[model samples]
Target: MEKDAGMVLHTLFEQTARRVPTLPALQWKADSLTYEELDRVADAVSGWLSRKGVGRGSFVGVLQERGLEMVVAILGSLKAGAAYLPLLPSWPTEQRLEILDEAGCCCLILQSAFRCESASFTGAKLELDDCRALARVEPPPAERAEVLPMDLAYLIYTSGSTGKPKGVMMHHGGTAANISRNAHLSCEEGTRCSFSNSYTFDVHVADIFKPLSVGGVVIVTRDIFRIPPVDTLSTLPSRVTRARVPRALKRIIFTGEPPTQASIVRIPSTTRVLNIFGATEFFDATLKIIDVHGCPSKLQSIGKPLGDYVPLWVMDPDSKELLQSGAVGELVVGGLQVSRGYIKRPELTSYKFFQAPWLASEKQEGGRVYRTGDLVRLCQDEEYEYLGRVEQQLKLNGHRIDCATVENKLTSIEGVSEAVVVLRDGDLERGQLVLVAYVSPSSAAVSVSSFRDGLPAHMVPTRVVGIDTWPRTSSGK
Candidate 1:
């Protein structure tokens, strides 16, 4: 792999600026920012941030929906030599504040209308719209800004112990590496798109960054695209082709609540669907591109690693050893794709990232491999079939959830002492969960109805069953 990290990103942006400056880079409800417009806005924001004493090594928190503002904020952060932290609007203000504190964010950017709403960041907050309001102002001072390839580019806040949040620090080198390897996968020039996805989800990063990096235009819409539209279930294919999704534009990407058959049938014959599998720690690990006729287009398998930067492994889960050819095990990954560590959290990082002895035999040392927590069976053909996660984590309607996270909430119920939750397969259009709980007699007086009232709709198990005692392992004390 090349040592220079920012080369790919700088090159992509420069190419797009030169070729498609007037093409729509971002399109919202009524407002659209062409490549030239977006570039100017990003530069303006960069200049404004520089005047505010923000530059290389600075962390800037961005709180905005997926729209023109989000695009500008991300590119601006890159230009300003700082990492941009994206926070979801649905996130609780208290949780957002805690993340800001952990990241040591000096300046927070938000929409002007959002300022009227409640937020709890102790850092200096700047209105994104207001920055545009001051567009007429010129940059104050120009200073030399130097950014190391390994300098932190962004810090994403993920779930943590103590029910708080932990920040995952990403470096420019790693970010640029992933973008470089995947930009070619996006739609080419003149492609129109309905940019539908929550900005917080890591998968959306590919959707936003890659398209923009290329000369294609991304139509930014307020209405979330992942949610299935019942009205267009029968006609989605034609609409999709007109929308010009990425090369792999299968209707299945729009995972809805139950996964309706109508929605599945809507996949046009011309649409190409790509099944993506990976975690935040590992971006775009594997790709299985399916044809509109629903056949594997690439290698009849998830293709090989993207760049010279990644190494893959299949290990025996119970033995915690490398599985020979045709043996099934948990998939482990190591290489440039592996991030340095979580921000200010060494314990968690050590727990997930560990020494891979298999690398020793391969003559590759001095690297840590991430245990993906995935179970895969190596086929005789040398390809791997994904079995599923070894834990309670599952993708329901395209949302990641750990049964433990919800089970913990159930046990917190006044009457419940212990709880177990499982996903039930059915109604591919809507997802449902079953919750089994054990409660004390006195606590039993607290009705299941009342207990459910205290939980979020998603956490409230569809079926609630009361148990007399909780199951325990043989080694239980």
Candidate 2:
């Protein structure tokens, strides 16, 4: 790795902090934190980690909820020159421990309020009861450790088709690229950002960093599943008079699962919602500026790639040939946004991230791109409309089935809160392909019979399991 492959993720945070010391860097509930304060506090955190022997390249587990503690832990870990691994408090204890052990984390940062299986961790704990108090501390011995851009910034785990979770290594360089590429998403000084997603998912990266990258303040919402209405973006003093939203604070960005069509219209018309799409391999490569005034025809068609910095190519999955206009093929994301690869799984890493001569520009090196399993079409308007996952196309009992279509259609039913359809491999010798549907809020009136009526008979699930909730991955399911 080059000594300065790119700018370290926290360098920009420190730069902005120095320039605007008293500017509000974050907002949690009624309390607010200044840029200078956050930086000084993170310095203290880095020093604390140094005393505990954590430094560059070490993975530190952050088991705090989305609040002051969580934000501080992330910034502090970066300042300490360590990769911050976010462990969602809601995750099962066994899964958390497995990930903790897998990453070989130096220590776990937890809030006093979080009651996790601490005994199971059996590791160093930095439990802060009042994270805000640290902002007033005196400068420490090791304020911020030196780190290379290639060094890991955070580690995110994603569930694999093979029934195991795999860790993806996101470096400082990749993170910087992601933010810089999507600068159009209202990354200005004093922009209001919402950190809604769990830190466990990489989506949190944009929510937290996009605002901080531009000296804007992030409203650290405790709510995990939803972003607050635009009116609520104000601090105590600002909301008193609602003349108009400040020009700088006009944009809100989110990924993973998108909001419903009805929910999108409810947001303030002034707010420009940027729907960002990307694979875990890259933070966010495609960003679409959705005009809330003119609602989308359908909830999909997530616009284009982020400028020329990152290239989006639709390629034939089997032949790897670049598809022309309007062709539905596997989406390939390339450019500076691509992460280093999977943490320790070389085979899986090689399988996903490969050289893409098809997408190479004169300035590009080796033309690296990540093969996203998502099926999307290059539309007539020069945007991409997500169809469904390639995995949905399964041949069972001599009938071709598209489970992705069924799942998309099934979610539209009024009573169904959420649903998951998976094609299971059972007794493959007899060509037994079992499609299982898991519906949440078990009492949800949506039934197997409805799926059969709505979907092609062959595409219908063989069994339906009504669980209280679908087993959600850190990505908020």
Strongest candidate by TM-score: 2
Position 133, candidate 1: lDDT: 49
Model 2, position 427, has a per-residue lDDT of 68
Model 2, span 193-289: residue lDDT tens: 6675667667777777767877888888855233443222312111111123333435545466543333354456666666777666786767676
What is the per-residue lDDT of model 1 for residues 236-328, given as tens digits with 9 covering 90 to 100? 111232232333442233211111122224365655444455555656666554454442112124545555576788887667688876665
lDDT top scorer: 2
Worst window of 10 by summed lDDT in candidate 2: 234-243
RMSD (Cα, Å) for all candidates, in order, is 11.5, 6.1
Candidate 1's error at 24, in angstroms? 2.1
Candidate 1, residue 71: the lDDT equals: 74
Reference-based TM-score, model 1: 0.71
Residue 270 lDDT in candidate 1: 54
lDDT for each of the candidates?
Answer: 0.59, 0.71
